[model samples]
Target: MDALSKSDPMLVVYTKMDGRLEEIGRTEVILNSLEPLWITKAMINYQFEIVQPLVFRIYDVDTKYHNTPLKTLNLAQQDFLGEAFCNLSEIVTKFNHSLTLNLRNGSGHALQGTVTVHAEETASSRMAVDMQFHCLNLDNKDTFSKSDPFLRVSRLSESAVAIPICKTEVIKNNLNPVWRPITLTSQQYSSKDDPLLVECFDFDASGNHELIGSLQTTIAQLENLYNSKAGANFYSHKGQKKLKGQLFLDKFQEKVQHTFLDYISSGFELNFMVAVDFTASNGDPRVPQSLHYIDPSGRPNSYQQAILGVSEVLQFYDNDRRFPAWGFGAKIPRGSVSHCFNLNASTNDCEVVGVEGIMSAYSSTLYSVSLAGPTLFGPVISKAAEIASHSVQYGNNKYFVLLIITVCNIYPHVTSVQKFYPSIVVCRMELSPTSKKQKILL
Candidate 1:
C-alpha cells in the first residue's frame, strides 16, 4: 500500500505489533493532518525521525479506500520518472499516509517522513522518505499573504487534477511524421520555441502541441464537415443564403466538438478518412464537360476543387497532415488497355499525388487518349466498401469515406440503373494514421 492508499490505521498499528510489515494487505491510506500552525503561519515545522514501517502479522488497511487509479503519472512525467525513483524524497511529502510513521516530536520538527515502500515493477523494497525540512517558520503566515511561498506543497483537490490528452487517427489522413510548431502569445517555462509536448498539463502548451501534429488536421475536416453542413442548413432555413443564430450555434457546437484543445482535455481521438469517386460518364476526356477536367487556364475541375479544398484545410490544421487519394472507373495507371476494374488501392499516399498526377494526366489524356464509354459506379464504390468493411479487421480507429463526384442528366432515354450515371468513383482512400495506404489517380 502506497501513501495514497486509504487503509485501516488500526490495521497499520496491528501490523507494527505483528512485526510482519511485508505481510501488509492492500488498502488505502488517507492523511488527515492540518496543524494549528497552518492557521497562524506560526511557522509550524516537522521533523521525521522515523515513521513506523509496515509491521505485519497479517497486514490489512488503515481506513476508507477508492478504486486504484488506472495510472498516476502523465506523459510529461517521463522526463524525470527515473530521477523521481532515484530520489524517493521527490514523491514523499510532508503530508503522506502510506505508513503510520512516528512523528519526530510529533509534526513540529524540520519536515521529514519515512515509510517502507515496495516497487511494483522491481519488487525491490526500501525505506521511502517524504521530507520537507528547511522551510522557515513563517511566523508571518498571516503577514506572508502578499509574498508567495518559494515552495508550497499539498495534495491536489479533485478539481485540480489535470486532464489527459488522447488521439484518434484516420486510416488515410494521418500520413505525416512531423508537425509544425505553433506560436504562443505567452510561452512559459523552458518550452519557448520548443515542440509541443502532447500530454503536459500546463494549460498553455497542452493545447498548442496537439494542433500542430498530424492528428489535429484530420479533426479539422470533421469540423469543416460539420460547419459546411450547418452553414448549408442555416442557408436553407432562411430560404436564402444568409447567416442566422442557428448558424452561430452550429459554429459554437463545432468549436466545442472538434477543437483539439477540448478533445485532449476530454480524452478523445479525432480521426476520419476521405474517399473520392472516379468513373466514366463524367464526360468524354476531349470535351470540357468532365468533372475531373483541367480547363484551358489550368484550373482544376470542380470535383478536384471541392475535394482539394477540404483536403487543404484538413492537412494544414489536423494532427495528421496527409491524405490518401484514389481513383476507380479506370485501370491502374500502368495497366495496358484501360482495364475496367482492378481495384487500385495503394497503401497511404498524399493528396498532392493524386491532385497533381490527375491534373497532369487529364491534360495529357485529353491530347493523346480517346474517351470511351462504359459507366461503372458499382465496381468503384464496391472497392470503397471493401475498405470500409475492414473496420473490424483493422480495429476501431479506422474509418473510410467515399465521396462520389457526379452530375446527373435526367433524360427519359437514360437507363434507370444506379450503376448508369454521370457519377464516378473518382477516388478511394484509407483514413487511419497507422495505415500506409493510398490510391493514385494517374
Candidate 2:
C-alpha cells in the first residue's frame, strides 16, 4: 500500500499577456508514481522578434481533494509544488537547444526536481490522427448487468511508461462494443514506429475502473491491419480470467501547409488593395441607419474596421506601404459607374500611402460621388489580378490581398483568382438583418 500511495504530479504552462500570466496549456496527470516522466509535450508559438515570457507550474494532485479539471490544486490560493520562469528565446539560444530549469517554491527556495526543456521548431503543419477499436469478447465485471466498455490509447514514453493521449467514450451494457473514433495530433500520436499501448476498461461511476485487457502495437502495425482489413486479435489475463480484442486504425493522413515564414524567407511581400461599395442600398450616408455612416461617436463602421484589422498586420511585410484604393457601383466625379475608379479621385495617382491614406480617400470620395446600384465586383477583381500577374512576370515576390465591402455574388472573380493563383486573399464583409453583428466571409 505504501508503494501505491505516492502523489500524482502534473505540469501547467502559462504565457505573459499584458504584464500578467495567462494559462495557455498543460500536461496530463502522471498517476501513482514517484518518478513520473510525462510523455505529453507542451507547444508554444515562437516569434523571433518579440520577448515572450513563459511560466511552468508543477503540482502534486491530491486525488482526495480534486478541484481543478486536471485534478490539481488551485495556484493562487494553494501554492504550486514549484514554479519556473524563462523567456522562450533563452531556451533556444542560452541553453544551446535544451536546458534544465530549476523549480522554486513561493518563498524562492529551490525544489527537489528540475524540469527539462528541449526546444524544437514548431511543426509547419498539423497532422490529425484518427483511431478506432472493437472488442471481440470483452470480460464482464458487473454483477447485475453487462460491463460498460471504453478504450484508451497511450504512447510508450522513453522513460519506460505509457502516457495516455486520447480516449473513446464509454458504451454502456455491451460485451462486444465498437468504440467511436478518436482524434489526436501528430505530436500527440508521436512517431509511427513508437510503441502505442491500447487498454480496454470496464468503467464504473464510483471512480474505480476495472481493466479488461491491454495490447501493445505501433501505428505502423495498425495501418497494416486497416489496409489488409483483417485486424490482429490479441489476448490478456486479469487475475485468472482471459480477455480478447481487436484494434483498428480508421484513418491517418498528414497535410502540410506553408506559413508566412516560408514566403517571408523567400523575399515575398504582401500588396494590399481595397474596394468599397457605393451602392444606393447603403442608404443616405447622412442617416444614422446607413451602414456607411461615420458614427457621431467617432467609431468606425464595419468597412473601416475590417480594412484596419487586416492591413495593420500586413503592413510589416509591405516595403513601401502603398495601397491602391478603388470604388465600384457609383457615379464618380467623372459621371461613370467605373468599377475600378480611384477613390482618391486622381487619374494618375491611384496608390495611397498607408491604411490611413486609404481611409482618407474613401471618406473624401463619399462627398464627391453619387451612390448608384446594380452592384458588380468582377472589374475590380480583374484589375487587381492584372497587377498581380504583372508582378509575377517581373519575378517579384508579391502577394495580393483584395478587401471587398459589398453584398453580391462574384463567381467570375473566383475564376479570375484561379487564373493567376497569385497568393490572393478576398475579405468580404456584409451586415446581417437578423443579427447586430457583421458577418465576414473569406
Q: Which candidate number has the best lDDT?
A: 2
Please provide, for model 1 over 1-442, each residue's C-alpha lDDT reduced to its tens digit, 9 standing for 90 to 100: 3356432221121223235423233222223422111110111111122222322211222232223331331223111101001111111221231223323322235224233332121111111211111111211212323211221112222454322223222111121111222211211111122222221110122233111111111223323544455321112211344322121112212111122222322322222234333445555544565554566787766655655644433232223433334444444445533422322233343233433443443344444434333434454445445554554355543333344333322222122322432222233222211221223330
Q: How many backbone overlaps does candidate 2 show?
A: 0
Off by over 4 Å in 1: 1-280, 289-292, 316-322, 331-370, 408-442
TM-score of 2: 0.52
- Per-model TM-score versus the true fold: 0.28, 0.52
User: C-alpha displacement of 266 in model 2, angstroms?
Assistant: 2.6
Q: What is the lDDT for 381 in model 1?
A: 46
